[model samples]
Target: MAKKSKQYEYDLSEVKRLIGETDKNYREIAAETGCPYASVVYHGRKIRGRVNRMRQEELNIEEQQPVLSITEETTETPKMLSGGTALSISRSDVHIHDAEQEAAKMIKAARALGLNKVNITIDR
Candidate 1:
């Protein structure tokens, strides 16, 4: 007589492993793992929620730092560009230019840290 093969049920371990491996949605995980859609949805929420919580905690810690830590003052006054620039800038214009430069530096730092487009989604 021939013996029949047994089917295995989806478990938490499999779901957690898939969650850690891919950033796919619950539906996608269900299709990929051959598990039930409801099961993936249920467990995937827990996994994603944990990750989002950790991210929030880290952000909270970073927010405690002082905003205006730089206290250095420039001794020299603003001067015109050495290349004979056509645009003449006033004192207020120099302040605005300094603000723009600071913003640019912040953007460069964010991109360097791989946070150019951080999307913290915990749902489908």
Candidate 2:
């Protein structure tokens, strides 16, 4: 069995500062900080959200504009399931309380289906 790697710790302040000062990509930041690329992306989003919220608060806007809006013509494509017979998932269908639970549910469902590996494609 393979050992799971530990998650890297990062200072929120530093993350905020770097995001504000530079337009570097998440992968670059991750490489420089020795953290996972996902972590870098997550932290960058968090920092951006906080900053945006602060700006909104300062502006005292009664209502905020929607970031995205769905129209009548918009169509959502059905998700496709593909791959092997032990259990691998590219995308997931189950809805759970958290991402961890969702992932577990996907794994369990794949096992139950006798799928060795599976790939899920979401057409949007």
Candidate 3:
């Protein structure tokens, strides 16, 4: 099994962009973002983590804009003696850039709710 890294409040995308677009090292980026140096390294390596909470408001506004139309349901089944049913999921408003992070959160929620199956579709 893979080890899960702790999440930080700073944005990973911003860290990645700085790493790619600037000559500054991790220490400098960490100083600028008010985040610890180790957290910067963890985000740079793309280990398991959560998106920055600092962008929550911005993400919510983006979700409100709604550029895509999603009708949200499909019945799926597999052959079994005592057939079961899959509960429907509520509408998930996911942003194009934050799909992966949003999906992670969704999966976490499902697990917390003791759900056994989960399916996520990211429409480009």
Candidate 4:
């Protein structure tokens, strides 16, 4: 008579989640979950690799799609950027996630206020 091989069900997702989200090490996770140390290490390495790939993909996407751009205002108008009054981006909530978006808004405001533009420099 032929017998089926034994199957063991283990939740590797839990280990992967801990590795990707928490600061816990593989040894700590293995100890906490009673999973084999080797299994934990293997899963941890795989999770980290996947995360790195995901981050790289995100960066590539960002690079492919420009964060900011100006399409020519397709109509007869005053010479574009035709002003002498130079204004600067001077103030805002410096701590922000999307600095480019904030700066774009500031520049748009400057243009509305009849400014060609001057400089955008940050210093410590």
TM-score of each: 0.31, 0.32, 0.31, 0.32
> Local distance difference test, per candidate?
0.53, 0.53, 0.61, 0.62
For 1-124, candidate 4 gives per-residue lDDT tens digits of: 9999655455677777887898777778887777777788788777776444457677677666534332222233333454543344454334333666667887798678776744565433
Tell me which of candidates 1 and 3 scores higher on lDDT: 3
Write the residue-wise lDDT of candidate 3 on 1-124 in tens digits. 9999776687767877876677566789998886779767786556323443346457788877765422224456622223464444434555567655666766676676666676554443
Off by over 4 Å in 1: 1-8, 50-124
In model 3, pairs of residues that clash are none
- Give the lDDT ranking, best first: 4, 3, 2, 1
CA deviation > 4 Å runs, candidate 2: 7-12, 49-124
- Clash totals, every prediction: 0, 8, 0, 0
Per-residue lDDT tens digits for candidate 1, residues 22-115, read: 7676777777777788677677677776444457577677556533221222244423244643222222222322555654554565465544
Q: Could you say which candidate leads in lDDT?
A: 4
Better of 2 and 3 by lDDT: 3
Candidate 4, superposed: residue stretches over 4 Å from native: 1-10, 50-124
TM-score of 3: 0.31
Model 4 poorest 10 in a row by lDDT? 69-78
Superposition TM-score, candidate 2 onto the true structure: 0.32
Query: Could you tell me which residue pairs clash in candidate 4?
Result: none
Task: State the RMSD for candidate 4.
Answer: 12.4
